[model samples]
Target: CSTFLHKLQRKSNRKRSVVSSGELHRNRRYAINPLGHKWDHHNLTYRIVAFPNTLNRDDTRKALSIAFTKWSDVSPLTFTEVTANATADITIGFYTFNHTDCWWSPLHPCFDGLNGELAHAFLPPRGEIHFDNHEFWILGKSRFSWAQGVWLNDLVQVAAHEIGHALGLWHSRDPQSLMHPNATYTGQRNVGQDDVWGIRRLYAADKKRVCDPWASTSASANDEILHEKNCPLRCDLPLESELPPRHVPRWLKWSLRCGHKNLRTTQNRYKTSPRASRAEGL
Candidate 1:
């Protein structure tokens, strides 16, 4: 992952372009590359050298394909998945502890095992995404027990965040964005306006195509697609235990006591609430 301080210098020298007010607002909500490092070409290829046992091989492939499509749909970039033998711009895999040049290695930052730090990726040109195999990874929707240190980290969500790093995006302050440092279990399968603007800022959208930066795609549609592909496990529903104690509002505490039958049901209600969707940061 790109270091926060090293790449955050303000880009005051580059000429600014006029964008839609909405897009402009979204762009301003996040951090961008100071040096503006980005892929020189539009077509990029990626190869999956390894797969996690958390999801079946086909599910893993489908999850990554959708993650790539999220970015490709709104940007000029196009991603082609190639075999391991073929040369590719990006390489992805799962690892634990000191796997090669990952965080624990002497060359890179140290990775905290299991729950603390989930994954990291290099910036553009490097194009390497590594997931911590120590953590439990989940595909779509499935029952998970957080108390057992078995909380399922959404693979597609993490893939999307790591891909942002690969595509030259730093972590965004906007928590709703796919580029946020932490993952949310709200079943956000589509890119947010903040992510769209950030990627577009790095590489302008293709001239032949027009994209809406703020359009919301149906998460249910994506879930249906995954189910149709035979990847039945869906973990999109919110887990009450997953919500940090700091985030639980006093009003929500009262609601939890009176409005809902159980913690799971309360969380499901909270997940759909507009306030929860807008809650910022990790």
Candidate 2:
């Protein structure tokens, strides 16, 4: 079985080529490395520092909270948003100016020197998520909802994907998985089964490795361990609580109730730039 690192090494040695539509096609069909293993439990708690621009702060926090809650449901993992001074394992921030945006790096880098992955996250000891700020950043409750226009990937959706990496999930071949490189808004509340399984596997594999300071194992060993502790041996419980429907803001509900024709005709006066996608090549 080839590990993620093994694949990376092989890719690096190969000639760098333009990521033609052909490359994207190959990537879509690319299988999950038979080598990547489940996560071993480390410290189950993580801290995130979300730096949203003042204009978008409220929406950013709301979206980020929803993203965090998605993972908490799958495992014993808990998350907290902290101030800059707080001791945290993970720090998340957004870019306001497009001058230094790195979001597109996963897709295309400046020079010929390119890394062929979408997002890359460090294991436990290294915790940070840097998103490219080059793209527009939009938030919820608008005309056409998530159904209209150019459908550049959704801000909240991208955050949710990167957050999966922050928690130790590898990219999944399952297009439905949140871990997939490119994703659009699906209006789902949680990670898909494939994403959950991948993260759960990480928890089990990483737990022991993180605790055993004396053990020196490679990615191959971790992969082997995960294959042995596969999904059939696991059990999952549904934890999503039903939220009581409260009267939402009148205008917001009215917008949804408005006929599709009206929605298409009305330009969104509330239209704002969307947040850039998080593209750290896996």
Cα-based TM-score, every candidate:
0.62, 0.48
Give the range where candidate 2 is weakest over 10 consecutive residues by summed lDDT.
Answer: 273-282
lDDT tens digits, residue span 83-197, model 1: 8799999999888776865444432455567676667777778888888778778776433686875777778877887888888887666668776655454555578877876
In the range 76-130, model 2's lDDT, one tens digit per residue, is 4667776667787776664432323334533222221111222234434455555
Number of backbone collisions per candidate, in order?
Answer: 8, 29
- Name the weakest run of 10 consecutive residues (lDDT summed) in model 1: 254-263
Off by over 4 Å in 1: 1-27, 103-108, 141-143, 146-149, 185-187, 206-282
Query: How accurate locally, in lDDT, is each candidate?
Result: 0.61, 0.42
